[model samples]
Target chain A: MPTIRVSANGEAALETRDVRVRYGNNEAIKGITMEIPRKRVVALIGPSGCGKSTLLRCFNRMNDLVPSAAVTGEVLFHGENLYADHVDPVEVRRRIGMVFQKPNPFPKSIYDNVAFGPRLYGRPPDLDDIVERSLRQAALWDEVKDRMNDNALGLSGGQQQRLCIARALAVTPEILLMDEPASALDPIASAKIEELIQQLVEHYTIVIVTHNMQQAARVSHYTAYLYIGELIEYDDTNTIFTAPHEKHTEDYVTGRFG
Target chain B: MSPADSARASRHFDQELQELRELLLRMASRAEEQVRNALAAVKQRDAQAAQRSIDRDGEIDALELEIEERTINLLARRQPMAGDLRTLVMTLKISTDIERVGDHAVNIAQCAKRLAEALPVPDVGDLDRMAEVSTGMLRDAIAAFIDRDAELARDVCQRDDQVDRYNDSVFRGMLSEMTRYPGAIVAALQMMLVARNLERIADLATNLGEDVIYIVEARTVKHHAGEVVSDVETEGEFDQ
Candidate 1:
C-alpha cells in the first residue's frame, strides 16, 4: 500500500490501512495502506495479475461475494472502520458505488436503469429529479433524454457505460470505483469516458484500475503502481510518468520490462 | 533509463528511438561542418566555399522537419513515458537548436562572402579562435548528449565563459582596428558580426549542454547554474 497524503484543505474520503486480501492460499493483495483523498482521482495501474483489481474491490467489499476470498486489515470510510463486523455491506456499496469493465446496464428501460439504485435502497420523494440529475451528471442526458423508455441494451457500448455511471450516481455515492471502465470502447468512446471522469471528480472521489498507463496519466491526480501484489510506488501522476522514484515503477512506466 | 535498461520490450519502439537519435546526431554534425566551412571561407577569402555553406543550410532545415515528423508519430503511436518521453521531447528541442546553429553558420558564411569581396581584409586570427572554441563546445555538447554524460555536459556549461571572453576581446580589438584603419571599416564591421555570430553559437551550444543534463539527470541546471554545486548533487533530486 502507498502512503496517504491528504489534500490541501480536505481530509481523506477513504483510507486503507495495511489492507490485505487472500484468496484461499494465494495472497492477492499483500499489504496496502493507501489514502483516497476527497474529490480526487487516484489510479491504480499495473500489469495483469498484479492485484490492482483485488485491491480496488476491497474498497466497497466486492470481494465478499467470493467465498474463497478473506480480507484482513482496516478500510476506513470517513473515519469509520468498514469491516468492524457491524456495518452493512449493502450500505457500504450504496455509498461507494462501482462500474465494471463491461457496460452491464440492465435490460430495462434507460430511465429505469438510472432509477434502479435509488429505488432498491428507498424511493425518494424527488425520484424524477434524482434520475434527471444523475443522467445530466453522467453527461448522457442530452443523448438519451428522449429515449428514456427505450431498452438500455439498445444503446451503444459507450452509452451503456455512461448509463452504468449514471446508475452509480443515482445513489449519490461519495466515491466511485471503476475497473477498466473504457477498455471495451473505441478511442472516441474512451475519450468521452475519460472526459466524464475529469468532470465527475468535482463531486466524487474516484479510484480507477486500468492497464492503460496513458489514461491514468491523463485523468488521475495521484497514481499508485502495483506489481506482483505489492505497491511499488505512488506519487503525483506527473511525477510517476515523468520521473518516478522507484526503479521498478520507472521500468514499468517506460515499457522496459516484459 | 539506465544504459542496460534503455531497451524497451517492443523492439520496434527501440528502433524508432534509435533512428531519432541518429537523425539528431546527423543534424548536429552537419551544423558543425557548416561552421567549419564558414570559418574556412573567412580564413582563405574563398567566396565559393562560403556560398556553399549558406546553400547547405536548407538541408539542415529539411532534416529538422523530418525529425519533427518522426517525433510526432512516435508520440502518437507509442505514448512514450518516463525516459523515452524525455528523449523524444529533448530530441525535438535539440533538433531545433541544431537547425538554429546551422542558421548562425549561414550568417557567418554570408559575412565571409561580403568580406571576401571587400578590400584589405583585416587579420581574422581572433575570429578563428572564437570559431574554434564555439565549434568545440558544439561538438562536446553533442558528444555529451550521445554518451548521456551529465558530468561532461556540466563541463561544457563551464566553458561558455571562455567563449564569452573571447568574443569580448575580438569585439574590442576590431573596434580599435576600425579606428586605426578607417579605410577598411567595412571589413572590420563584417568581422565583428562574424564574432557576434560565433558568440551566439556558443550560447546555443551551452543550451544544448543544459538539455543534455536535463535528459540524463532529469534535473534542470539551466538558469540555476550558481546553485548547482556538482553533477553528483543533481542526481537524486528527480522528484523536483
Candidate 2:
C-alpha cells in the first residue's frame, strides 16, 4: 500500500510478491509483497515472533533449510523468479548472502573464515585479492589485517560478527540478508555493525531485522512494520517513526505494544 | 480510549504524557484569564485589576520552563515516536507561545495602568471587540489542542485576521481622537498600545492553532492558504 522508490537505478535489488511461509501446520509468514530498494537498507521490525526474521530469510531462500517449511509465491532477485524449477537453490544463496544474529564464524583463521565461501567454488585465481576486498568491505580488515591467521573465535563478539559479515561478503553477493545482526553484541560493538551496515549499502542492498526500534531508525532508509505475521505498514523511515499510517505500527514503534 | 491503546497495559510514559497535557492546559488557562482580566482593566480603567493581571505573568513563565524540562527529559528517556513524539515537541512550542502571550498581557495591563492616570479619551470602541476576538481565539485554540480537533484549530487560525482588522480600526480612530483633542494624547496613545497588545495575542493564538494542527494531523498549515490538504485519516482498528 506504500509507494516507495527502489533505487537511483530504478531497479529493485529484491522483491517478494505474496510470499508466505508455513512451518508444518503453523504459518510463520503471511503473504507479504514489498520491494527492497537497491543499495539501501530496509529494516523489518516488530515484537517477538512477528515474522521479521522469517521474511528476511525469504529473500535468500534460507527458509528452504527447514524441512517442514513450505514457501508459496515468488522471491525475485533482480527480476528473476528464484523459485523457478530450473534454478539452483545453492546458487541463489551464493548471489544473495546472509548473516545470522550470532557471530557464527568458522573455527579457522580470520583469512580462512573469509575465504571459506570463495574457496567452496574452487579457489579463484586471485583468492588473496578476494579475501582482502571482502574483509575491507565488511569494515573489519583494519582490525584483523595483521592477524589474518588468528582464530576467528578469539576475536571479540563484535569483531566476530564483522568477520561473519566479511565471510558473507567474500563471494561478491549482490544482496545481503541479516537477521538481528547486532542484537547479540554490546552497545559499542552493535554501534559498529550498524555503522558498517550504513557503509555496506553503498555497494550492496542490505535487509536487516532488528528488535531495537532505535537501531532501525538509525540505520535504515525504509522500515516495514509486521504484526501478527502480516505486513501492517511499510513506509520511509521518517514516516514510520514520526507519523506511521497504521495505529499498530505507531503503537509498536512507540513501545505501546502489548 | 482506542482499543489498540486500551489493550496494552499503560506505560509510565503514558503518565508522563498525561502530566504534560495537564500542565499545558493549566498554562493555557492562566494565559486566557490574563487576557480577559487585562481587557477588563482597560474597559473600566481599573489599575488594581491591571496589577492583578500583571502579577500572574511570573507563574506562566515558570510553567513554561517546567514544561520544557519535562518534555526534553521524556524525549531523551522515552525516545517517543509518532503521536507521542509530536505531542512532546508541540508542548514545547505551544508553551513558548503561551508564555509570550503572557508577556503581551503584561504590556496591555501596563497601558491600562498608564491610562488610569490620564485624561479620558472617548472610547475607540474597537478595543472591546478586538478583546473578544483575540480572547475567543486563545480559548478555542487551547480547546482544539485538548480535544485534538484540527477543524476547530483551523477555525481559530481563520479568526486571526479579524483581530488585525479591529487593530487597524482602533489605530485610525485613535489618530483622530489625538488630533481633535490635543490634551487626550496620553490617553489615546495608551489605548493604541492596548490594541497592539491584543493584536499580538491574536497572532500568538494563530500560532497555537498551527501547532495544534501539527499535533493532530502531522501536517504544517502555517504558510498555506486556508485549505489544509493533509492526510487526516487516522481512524480504524489496529490489527493486533
Candidate 3:
C-alpha cells in the first residue's frame, strides 16, 4: 500500500535473466528470469520436475557437479556476472553456500562439522570465534555448545540439518540456497528449520525450493511459481496466495491441477 | 478419486460463499424497497402495500437469523484465515444492518396505519424524491457490497449528503404545512418521522457499503468520504 515500489531501487541479491539449463538433450530450465531481493526469502514452489530445484542449484553453480549438465544465460550476484569465465566458481560456492534436501552432515565432530567450511577456505585468525558465531547464528549453539566434540551423526536428523546450516554459515556466505531443507525431517523439526530460516533472513539472502505451499506462504516474503520448466508468476507471498495475476498461479496455489 | 470431482467440490465451496453473500444482498434490497413502498403508502393512504411491507419484515427477519447461523458455522468449521475471516465477519455485520433496516420498514408501516385515517397532509414533493434517492442509495450500496466495488461504495457514501439535504427539506416543509394547517399537524408529524427514518436507512446503507469496502480493499472508508472525494477531485495527489 505504500506509494514507493518495494522492488524499484534495492540491489538484487541474486538474479537470473533468460537462464536456460539443459541435461544432455533435455532442457531443464527454459527461459526463466527473476530477481531475489536482498535479505529476503524467495520461495520457489511447483510440482516435481518443474525446474525449481534445477534453477536453485544454478545460483551457486551446484549443477556443474552434474557432468552432463550445462547452463546458459546470466546468473548475477550483486551486479557481478557469476557465470563469467574470470569469476572462480569455487569462490562463488563459498559466498553462496547451500543446504540440500537431506541433511548431509559430515561424519565428524560437531565442532569440526561447522569448522569444516572455515578451515577449507583457510581459517581466519578467529577460527574459534567463527565456529561459535556460525553455530549461534544458525540457532543451534545452545543445544550443542557443551557437546561440540560429539559426532554430528549422533545428533537427530533436524539437529544435523541445523549443523549443515551452521556449516554453510561458517563460510560467511552472502546468499543461502536451500532445496527443501526440511523435507526429510518430522513436522516439529520442519517447523524448527522454518523458524531458523525466518531468523536467518535477517543476515542472509535466501532462495528456497519447496513443494509445500503452506510452508512457502508461512515463511516467504516473495513466492515464485514455476510449471514445466517455465516461470509462471512471481510476486509478494500474500498476493500470490490471495490474488495471483496468472491463472496458472491461482490454480496451483488453490490446489487445482498443476 | 477424480480431478473433476475435486474441482467440483472446490467450486461448490466457492458457490456456497457466493450464495450467502447474494442472499444478504437480496434481503438488503428488499428491505430498502419496502422503505420506498411504505413512503408511497403513507402519502397515498394505500393500505395494501403498507400491509405488504409489514408482512415482508418476517421474511427479512428469517433471513437475518439464517445468515448469522451460516456465518457462525463458517467461522467455527472452516477456520478461515485472513481475507476469508474478513468476509465472514463482514457478512455477520451486514446481516445485522439489514435486519435493523427491516425493523425501520415495519415502524414506517405502523406510522402509515395511524396516519391513514387522519386528514391528508399536503404532498411535499421532496419527501417522495428523498424516499426514492434513499432507496436507490440503499440498493446501489448493497450492490457495491456484493460486487466489492470500492468506487461504487464511495459514490454511495457521497450520495448520503443528498438524502440528508432532502430530509431537512422534508422537515421544514412539514413544519410550514403544520403551521399553515394546524388541524393536519399530527399527520404531518408522522410523515416527517417516516422521512427521518428513510434518511437513517440511507445512512445505514452507507455504513454497509463502507464495511464492504473495508472487507474487500482492506481500507477503512468510514468517516473518510471527504478523503475519497478529495482524492477523486485531485486524482494525481493520493496513492491508489
**What is the C-alpha DockQ of each candidate?**
0.40, 0.38, 0.18
- Evaluated at residue B27, the lDDT of candidate 2 is 97
TM-score of 2: 0.93
Best by TM-score: 2
Please state the CAPRI-style docking class of candidate 1. Answer: acceptable
What CAPRI class is candidate 2? acceptable
Better of 1 and 3 by lDDT: 1
Residue A250, candidate 1: C-alpha displacement in angstroms:
2.7
Clashing pairs in 3: none
Model 2 agreement with the true structure over B1-240: per-residue lDDT tens digits = 343554453476788889999999999999999988888888788999999999989999999999999999999987888989999998999999999999999999999899889998975767788888989999999999999999999988887777777877888888889999988999998888888888778878888999999888898887675464222131111101
Tens digits of per-residue lDDT for model 1 on A79-138? 898888999999999999999999999999999999999899888889999999999999
lDDT of 3 by residue, A107-134 (tens): 9999999989888878678988999999
Please list the C-alpha lDDT of all candidates, in the order they appear: 0.87, 0.86, 0.82
User: How far out, in Å, is residue B122 in model 2?
Assistant: 0.3
Fraction of true contacts kept, per model? 0.67, 0.58, 0.08
As for lDDT, the candidate ahead, 2 or 3, is: 2
- Model 1 DockQ (Cα-based): 0.40
lDDT of 3 at A98: 96
Model 1 chain B lDDT-worst window of ten? B230-239
Q: Interface RMSD for every prediction, one decimal?
A: 5.0, 4.1, 4.6
